[model samples]
Target: MGENIDVVVIGGGYAGVMAANRLTRRDDVAVTVVNPRSVFVPRLRLHQLVGETHDAVVDYETVLAEGVRLVLDSATGIDAATRRVKLAEGGDIGYDYLVYATGSGSPSPRVPGAAEFGYPVATLEAARRLRSVLCDTPVSAPVTVVGAGPTGIETASELAERGRAVTLVCGGALGPYLHPRARRTARKYLARLGVSVIEGSDTTVTSVKRDAVELGDGRTVASQVTIWAAGFSVSGLAERSGLRADAAGRLLTDETLTSVDDERIVAAGDAAAPSDLPFRMGAYIAGCLGAHAADTVLSRIAGDEPAPVDLSFPAMCVSFGRRTAIFQLARKNDVAVPFYFTGAAGRKLKEFSCESSVEHLVNEARKPGSHHWPKAGKHRPVVLAAQRGESAAPAARDT
Candidate 1:
């Protein structure tokens, strides 16, 4: 055999781990995963971590495939011209190919005093800190959760279920991604848990103080603890390395997930913006993109053209505490439909999804190239065509 191809995957999140494991399909490829933490973190379960229900970490030994080298360090930058990744702890690792999968983190809050007083629960470290703060505060203390996204809702409901006075502030509609029907159901469940739901155009948080939060409507809510789940943002590693990235810091790539500036480099998971359009950030999408990225690398190795990504979102599930949940079904294009499942069935589905996500990684580690996802037709091309003011090709239509 020829010299082994060294493939370095930055970030050991779902995408990086899956990409690293799938690369094992080629015996000639040597995979090395560079991550800050030794343990794998299930980002979806971060709220549970804050509520003291789960730790939100897994052993890499159980998820990473055998023979894959795990480097317990963070990637400071990528020197694409030299095919090396700079490490935070010093030194660099040379690679024949590189996968960019640095996942995401809480955006630097812009609201006045939010940076000083608000607590974000997007990443593992943030969740741990929030958990610590909650432990010290009395259960009777008023807690205000900002943002109506899944993270905000989950955190608010989890705390409310624990008998804490919780207030969920939605900048606009509750669960913007959920269908109206699903949104109503979610509101009902949250109310049943004794959560005060605040929604409307004027519900935006103007500022966060140590003991209160001011809303746009000029109302100051008493919040002994403020949890910020506004949204997530990717690291600046790509832009820091002089690579092109979208406004949100996601590394820009072609539809095949290959870096536009450097074909030798690919991106996956939440850190990747393909065709300037990224999939919804989640473990499920990350795993699929990871596998597709590995296939692109393997194709390059075999001197074949890599195929474009073909996957679809079927449903989105969010839990209300540990008992009730909502599963909003969507079309292949990811637009939510009126149909949804709630209550016991929804709870079971949400749990299954969380467990199956981890199981998918373990399965891929045991069997490389075994991961697969349903195709959503050529919807992206059609959408892009429409954006360009050009007629869509017949083949781009959904079948």
Candidate 2:
């Protein structure tokens, strides 16, 4: 056998798993996936965990390729100069190529008393804890869900369907990325499920209490339980390791997904900012970037220039309980249009998208480069500029 290329992927989220699987396309590349957990957390169904409707986890044996090695450990640091990753348990992995895919998690809330009083739903343990709390709490308890993004909306609606009193407090507009029609559809379904949708500038949570939550506008919402789905925050390993990263700790990379400061290191999923513009955090985008990141490594191995990532959002789906949902069609640039599917049709589509994401990962595990996605035409300029080593263009804040 020829000399093997060691590719170490940090994180076992959708991106890491997909990257590990796809890296098997190369016969000379040995892939190792490092994660703290043994099982893959299906974050899409975490709300179902809170509702006790589904188990939001799957064994890595079912998702990861046979050629991939699963290391149950966390990456504590990275030494880009040495091409080695430090593990929390105590060893270092030397890699010819490294993939940073450590996904995001619920941030420690800055709001007064929030961290002490609220529950976050970004990981397996968090969801399991929240599910236990929900199961123990009385059905008639007042539950306040802070944030109106997909996680918050889905959690609130799913609980409401279970007969819990849920109030969805939006710090801003509900589903701000959704088109007006899609937003309307979401609101209708939420209202039908008896979820109180609180919006406007005053809806921001200022403080959390034992039995209530205080709003910025001096209003108090009665609640026996509070679920904090406000937003996700990535790991600080990149920033701490002196890797060039954005303010949110996402490693800054070129359009080809290669770290701007280090050609030997690439990044994927929510941890990667390509051309200074990170894609919206979701399973769909994560799976795509995972494949692209692997491709970049393969390109380097083959002595060819890695192609810039080509990606587009065909649609974004939001579930409003198990019975209803909203699938908002998007342009290539990911702007939600008026066209959408709602009710049961939307629900089915949402379900399929979730299922297909895992299926895509499994297929890639078995078939290597079996995954593919549409290209965004508008991203051409950005890609060209990145390849030319030009300055980064300003990015709009969407997700």
Candidate 3:
């Protein structure tokens, strides 16, 4: 056989790891995952980490295939012309195909004093640091959580359940992704858990102080600790490396997940912007993107055209402490439906979703290409129409 196809995946998170394991399906491909850490961070449990309820770390040995190499280092840049990835620690590694899955981080807050006074709990290290500080804080101290996304809700609920006074500051609607009915149910559950839900256009933190958080409306909430979980931002490595990237620094790719600037470079997860539109950042979509990237490489090696990605969101889960949760069912377009799962049933489903995410990776390692998700209704018709050389409406861009 000729030289083996060297595939270098940058990142050890869900997407990168899944891509690495799935690449093992072909003996001609050798996968190397270069990440800043050796252990996998179960991002879904980051809130539990702050509550000291879960460690949220997984050994790579249990999730990676035997032939995949793990490089505990960060990618500084990529020389696509030479197929070489620059490493932060030192030298460079050459590859025949590159999977850009650097993922994302908790976005830097724009409010004054937020960076210096607020704590972020997006990664394992950050979560551990937040947990340590919480341990030192008095149990009765008022803690404020800014941002009403899933992370913000989960963090506030977790802290309230642990006896810390938590106030969820929603700059807008709480759980905007949830339908009005589902959101009402969630708010009630959080209220029962002793969490204060503040929702308003002017509720955003204008400034964060060591002892309090100032809102846009000039109201101040007494706080001993401030947790920020507003949004996420991808690294600028792709843009810096001269690759085509969107405004957020996510690598731009075609529908097949192949880089628009470089065909050999495939992107997945939050860092991938396909056709100027990116999928929402979540474990389910990330896994689907990762697996699709792998399939693209294998198809190329077999001299066949790669298929475009087809994915959908079945539901969204949010935990309001250990006992109460809400699973918001979605339509094909990802619009939350009025019907939903809540209470103990929702909690069980949330737990299952978290656990099964890990299981999906491990099972993929044992049997590549075993992981599969249903395609959204909108995507299926478009794809089929394209195959038949017929024009179709564009897929919905909303998450």
Which has the greatest TM-score?
A: 1
Encode model 1's per-residue lDDT on 278-341: one tens digit a residue.
8999899999999999999999999998888888999999999999899889999999999998
List runs of model 1 lying over 4 Å from the truth.
391-399
Across 40-96, the per-residue lDDT of candidate 2 in tens digits comes to 988999999999899999999999999799999999999988989999999899999
Q: Report lDDT (Cα) of residue 301, candidate 2.
A: 91
Sorted on lDDT, highest at the top, how do the candidates line up?
A: 1, 2, 3
Which window of ten consecutive residues has the lowest lDDT sum in model 1?
Answer: 390-399
Model 2, runs deviating above 4 Å: 380-399
Colliding pairs, model 1: none
Q: What value does the lDDT take at residue 19 in candidate 2?
A: 93
Which candidate has the top score in lDDT? 1
lDDT of 1 at 129: 99
Give the worst 10-residue stretch by lDDT in candidate 3: 390-399
**Model 3, C-alpha of 230: deviation from truth (Å):** 0.4
